[model samples]
Target: MLLLDLLLMLLIAYGFGFLYYGLYRNLSARVHGRFGPSLAQSFSDSIKLFVKEESTTFGWMFYLGPVIMASGAVLNVLFIPFLNQGESLQGLSSYGNLIVVLYLMVLGPLGNALGVGSSGNPFGVMGVTRGLTRLLALELPFYLAAIGVMIDAGSADFGIIMQAQSTQSNMFAHPLLFAAAFISFLGFMGKSPFDVVGAPQEVYSGPATEFSGKFLALLMSQSAMFSFAKLLLMVNLFWGGADHLGELVAKTFVLFVAATFIGSVYARFSTVQSVEFLIRIPTLLGIVGLALL
Candidate 1:
């Protein structure tokens, strides 16, 4: 059962990732009024990446970093509830909690930082520095918002939070938290307005520039996995995980669409702008939510 559950979580994450990749292509094509690649383009790209020769200037740690990051993402997904009354798998929820999940979310980036730093690429190092710097401001609002949820629900356990939301969705009770989290979520998703860390214009894909071949494949997979994990976290926190897969998908899609729209409409912010905004506005709102709760 454990193995099966793990497989199911990974499969679902990968499937969603593929869908998002397709959405990216189709969305871009529509934006420009041009034809786009097939929906399976991401899958083909992954296949090609996997088969490509491994290239590394760093060391085995660089190779291992992405693997660890991807593993963390898969584990994170397995711990989040996708449907109420259903756990990722029996016994898996024993260790799952808001605190642990938040740490798990950071695990991948930490690994990437170490690996990228070891590479000695100026851009990779710069990107890593920028990412960690931005994380400081982004984290405060998210933490405050999470604390508001804990106060409203009376526990840090994600399952309990969901049960509490089942009575009344947290979104309604703590709209301020929802706003703060949504604001942080924009940064978490690495969308345009908060995407300074990996800006191609300045950093040339940032930490990922030095990676190619199998290493690139692992990084890409982990990125998608992280994206899905973030979405599931939002679903659990705001949408109650729904009662069925279709509902879950629909709600998740709506959230993603909101994110996409926000990402598209806003111009990219400088790292300083991102940090300043996160600290000043969302932080205040999160504190307000905590007070209200």
Candidate 2:
């Protein structure tokens, strides 16, 4: 049953991710006054990539990296809630909390960085450097928002956090943190401004440029997982966990739209500029939120 529940959550998150891939394309197209591909475009792309020829630069480690990344993403999905009190596979809520989730969230990216580094591509290495650079700044607001939630809830377990918000959402209590977090989330989503790592104009898809075939397919799927996990994290942090599946989807869609708009409205920032922006603004807000708490 636990295994089945875990699989179900993975499937659900993947479905959302698949939908998001199409949603992004369609929305981007609409903004440009051009009709876009159907919402299944992402699924189509994944299918095409799956049957393509596999290429490898590094040996055993390259093969291992995607697998590890996907595994970590799957673990992350199981740890978060979709339908409140609905189902949790690992029963890890007892030991798990914001701190654990935060650590787990980085695991997939770390694995991807390792894989990309092993491939011996200068561009991929540059992407990893940009990713880490941006991460250093972007993490502060998220950390501040998370700590505020922890303090308000008096516990780090997400379920308890949700319960605490049943009476009053954290967004009200920590508006500064929310603003900081929401802004930082833009960076986290790798949209404009903070998309330095994968900026096609500059880095040529960055770290994943060298990936092909099955490995690429796995990476794509993991991207969807990462997207879903991020939405879940945001919802849990600000609004608390959704009370129903419909509510969950609604919240996720709202976040997706917000991320897309931010991506569209802002021009891409250079790595240094992005780091500077995160540091001076969101970082300071986070510090204030923590101090206020």
Candidate 3:
């Protein structure tokens, strides 16, 4: 029964994740005054990559990279409760807390970095370096906000946090913290102004430069699932977890649309610029939010 629930969760993550990705492209194209591909284009692309004739690898480590990344993503989905108060949708969330989920989030990227480094691709290494550098600053405000949430609720448990917000969602009770987190969340979604890690013109696809065929397909699949996990995290933390699947879709879609529109308007930031901006602005908001708490 537990395994069946887990499978259902993965299916939801993959389905909605790709749906949002395709919507992101379509929305961005509209902003640029051009028609975009259909909403299923992302799924089609993933299938095409999977069926490609060949893929390159740099030995066992490289081969394991995408697998490890996918594992981390899957673990994240499995550990996070889909509903605020329900046995049906909750997976292994009872066995973990926010801190555990936070640590799991970084596992995939770190594993991918190792594989990219071993692939002997200078561009991939550079991309990984930029990603790591950006992450240091990216995580600060988010961590601070998360800490404030946990402290306020007096527990690291998601259910506790959600219960504390029964009268008022965190987005309202703690606007400053939400502001700080939302800004950082924009970066987490790889929006413009914080998307230097994979700037095609600059890094030739960044950490993904050497990946092809099935490896690339696996990365895409993991990315879709990871993206949903991040969205679910924010919804649970701030918007309040949903009681039903429809409510969940509505909240996450609103958040996703906000990130997409913001990303479309801004230009890409240099690595140094992004780090400096994050350190100064969102970090300051987070500190102030914590102090207010």
Candidate 4:
């Protein structure tokens, strides 16, 4: 039964991850005053990539990159509970806490970086450097906000935190912290302003330059799953965990839409600008919020 639950969790993560990404592209298109591809387009693209063979191979390291990335995403999905309830719906939520989920979120990107580094492509190397540079700045504010929440609950456990929100969700209890985390979340999602990592222009000279065919496909699928895991983390932390599957969808969709809309309107920042903005704004807010806590 536990194994079945775990498999269901992975299926949901992968399925909804692709669906949400397709929604993002659609939302981005509408905001830009243009029509986008169908909602299934993301899945279709993944299938196409799966069938296409890579023309060049950079050895075992490159092959292991996407697998490592996907593994992190899977762990994240398994760690976070889908609904705030008994041990049944919770996957491995009993065994882990918010801290573990946060760390796993970082693992995927770092894993991808290792693979990119092994490629010997200067562009991929540069992209990884820029991404890791942003990542370092990314964690401070988020970690600060997370610490505040854990302190408030007097425990690092997700169950305890969610239960505390039975009266008032963290969004209201700690708006500043949520705001700080939300900003970091946007950057984490590779959204605009902070999306300096692999924007189309950046990718032309960035990480995706080296990967092709199945490698690229694996990256895309893992990215989608990782993104949904981030959404799940935010929902669990800020909104309080949902009561049912329907409630879960609505909460995550609203958060997803808010981020997508914000991403669409904002211009992509340069690497330096993104790093500075994250440090100055979100980090400062997190500091103030933590101080209050």
* Top of the candidates by TM-score: 3
Candidate 1 local lDDT, 59-97, one digit each (tens): 878777677788788778877766777654322556678
Relative to the true structure, candidate 4 reaches a TM of 0.97
Q: After superposition, how far is residue 155 of candidate 2 from its true place, in Å?
A: 0.6
List CA RMSD, all candidates.
Answer: 1.5, 1.6, 0.8, 1.1
Measured with C-alpha atoms, the lDDT of residue 195 in candidate 1 is 92
With a 3 Å backbone cut-off (N, CA, C), the pairs that clash in candidate 4 are none
lDDT of 2 by residue, 1-293 (tens): 76687677888989998898789889988887899999998898899989987655688787777888898888777777665565553334545777887888788778888888888889998998889888878887788788888888898888888888887777887888898999888887888878898999888989888888888889889889888888988898888778777898899999898889779878888999988999888878888888887
Compared with the true structure, all predictions reach lDDT values of 0.82, 0.83, 0.92, 0.89
Residue pairs that clash (backbone atoms under 3 angstroms), model 1: none
Predicted structure with the largest lDDT when compared to the true one: 3
lDDT per residue for candidate 4 within 80-180, as digits (tens), equals 99899865668999899988888888888788888888888887888888899999899989999999999998999988999989999999999999999
Q: Could you give me the TM-score of model 1 versus the true structure?
A: 0.95
The TM-scores, one per candidate, come to 0.95, 0.95, 0.98, 0.97
Instruction: Residues 73-165, candidate 3: write the lDDT tens digits.
Output: 999998889999878779899999999999998888898898888898999999999998888898999999999999989999989998888
Quote the lDDT for 245 in model 2. Answer: 79
